[model samples]
Target chain A: MKKILLALSLVMIGIAYHNNVKAQSEEELVQICTMVAGDAEYLKDFRIKLDAGDPPPVQRFPVVLKKDVKYRFSVCNSKDYEGKVILQLFDNNRQLATTYIVATGKDYPYIDWVCTKTGAYHLVYSFRDGKAGLAVGLLSMVGTM
Target chain B: MIKHRVILYQALIIVLLSQVLSSCSFCSRQDVDLSQELIVPDSVIQNSTPQVSKAITDQMMQNISSPVETAALIKGLKIPFNKNFLASTKQADWFNTNFEKAFALGLYGCDLGYLNMYEKTSFVVDYISVIKRLADDIQVGQFFDFSTLKRLATNNENLDSLILISQQSFNRIDTYLSETNRSMLSAVIVTGVWVEGAYLSSRVAQISNHPKIRETIGEQKVILNFLLALLKVYDNDPSMAKLITDFEPIKKLYDQVHITYELGEPEMIEENGVVTFKQTDKQVIEMDDELYNKLITNIQELRSNLLKL
Candidate 1:
């Protein structure tokens, strides 16, 4: 009972203190993403909460990517999170592209990849350097062209 | 793939052993060593609940892409909504075992996704009721919020909202199940959704000329292996054991599929606040027509078996 109460309290605080937490709980993400998904199609979505100093968790989703389809990977993070949360795209063997850039100092809301392959690919997600926050990653096909 | 196969082989050997032990009612046996490679990670989603559920669920949610997207692909393929293909709602009452309930919950989840995608608002109640019945049986009905979902479904404009809320409701159930140590049920729900989604695509691909559907079906080779590995962790349980054993033939068909990737340069582009990449990497699927037809037929059989119980 005490642990349950403590966990609830922590989540509440996590929401109140971190504007970076766009989603208070998974429920909030649903309501927000409903509006966010728009006319655009929905694909796979992942909700994650990160803590400081923890190696950004690598959650891998194995999906088939066909040649000629334009695939989009986007993130909806708490706006208060100052640091960029990065989403990387990797084919079975090689690292393809990431949602954020370091030297150019630009972080993208999403990564749009026109797949030339029709096999499985992995969409990996993480945050910068032990950054603490909650984010939802969305995969969609914006177009075929 | 060799390493994965080796891991699966070792895992299944333990599953066979566990099956033997359970058959002898070895629950009280002190000699039975319980240490096995658990797919559930030690920590997921900031460590709030039982680690077992989160680990398995994280692994699960990753592998099964939302069927809504598959519905979209079917739509993009210009395939019409064929209600005749969905598992019958009347059968929801037939499921007496937790195994059946979990699988039915999943079957209907895909049905709901398919319905929502086609904007077939009137038919939503059939699935929502069956899912509610299953969810209630599993003691997670509180998370479903039936009234709110009904309201969302009644309005045509809220179709998008309905899908989002449905996703949210399921996630809430995942959280609740993980916290309450009822994640085995969660595993079944995930599996049911995967099976239905796979079956739905196969059914549509049969008549549709979409190449994506064919490749997507072929890609299940890896996902199935991953799902079987996780399900085998609970092979000691009778229902889980049966599911694991029953799913082997599908895995055999998948074994014949050869998926290879030709590496290419990945390009990045940024325009008007949208950042996108063009993946030059291409995946080639090698499977003859005979194998593809056989695989689809097997998927249909599996789905049919699921609905029967």
Candidate 2:
């Protein structure tokens, strides 16, 4: 009976510690996002943590972009992780904007998009050089056109 | 006697383990069997189960627009705040069912967004109190840091934090609901927010014919289509069925409205080393005044029906 109780207590403690760590990491990520949000009205935020062992090439999230509204997509990488993120806004026809400039080999922290079409637009987040990473993405409405 | 005591302790441990294990996946065999029986053919019952398409649910979850933006846009027009357009806070306790509570929570969230944007700090506490009650009723109250939100709402200087924190609270609740397979509740909340938002915008448009308000009203046609598709995914639920029925008239009215985009030369400007790609494209929303009036009328009726529901 003592052995069983000990095992259960260990499991409970492990679970609690795991949850606390996760909550702290997420809170830190959200704080980074809030700092980057600037004067834009907060709409939605995306929290991305990729497996370090085998990270995917890209993670895609769909957002319904309204016509004639200026939107800002901001990204910040967790300092604990080595990976820097590249955020892209695109649809079926063309890539509207991206944070990393391929030719310049540079990355901006955010992408400002004045959406013309009211449809499902994709926000693709990927680590620079396809490295594993943790990042947070924020979507804010700058204004209506 | 010690042996008997040990046996009792072992039995209690077994019961506790079973409860814990049962709470995890693979324990709900009855539910799994029932679902399988409904879909699987007799010959392949042991081998196959139908896969649910996550596309509709995904789109539905993604399409939940922030009412704060709508409220902000309304504020941009310099319109006076009308308390009449808001859902009654007195009806907070009146919602007994999970469906009604979740829906009313959405309504109050929208109203709170409006109140926050308009800087009505004094009236904000009432909405926040009712919001807490409804949120608690639905068992998602943990996501809301009520004390922090209350403090922010009480201070006019903290409007920005109030809006961000409130939106974050809703976002957290939504994420929780989705993760826990309680997406039906999340969908209802989205529906509530959308309806309340549309009602507020249209009501303002009726009083003052602002072009931006009209355009916002017209944009709802696109959002309405997405909302309808989302709601249709759960049409099996009676509450959802009624919601769909209530919204159909508004949808029909919106169908007559036209939104066409004229692509312009995209302009890329860099300010302080920050690049902004401004699409010179213009979206022309062509809706006759008659159809706009009809849409507004139907939306009002839908809101009325929802409040009673």
Best by the DockQ measure = 2
Q: Model 1, range A1-145, lDDT digits (tens) per residue? A: 4454465456545544543342345446544543454455555566655555565545455455545567777677766565446877765446788877877877766667777754445666667875765677776656554
Across residues B1-309, which tens digit of lDDT does each residue of candidate 1 receive? 667656655655665565445433213322321112122221211112223333434435433545565666677777899998788888888899887898788779888988988899889977888888899998889999788888877665667667766776776776677657777777788788889888988998788767888887887765565566557657789999889777878887887888776667877777777666776656678899999999999998888876774
RMSD (Å) of each candidate, 1 decimal: 13.5, 7.6
**TM-scores of the candidates in the order shown:** 0.74, 0.84
Candidate 1: stretches off by over 4 Å: A1-38, A41-71, A76-82, A91-94, A114-145, B1-57
Note the DockQ of each predicted structure: 0.23, 0.31
* lDDT per model vs. reference: 0.68, 0.75
Q: Which tens-of-lDDT digit does each residue in B68-120 have in candidate 2?
A: 87787788788999999898888777778999898888889899999988888
True lDDT of residue B71, candidate 2: 88
Give the C-alpha miss distance for residue A56 in model 1, angstroms.
Answer: 7.7
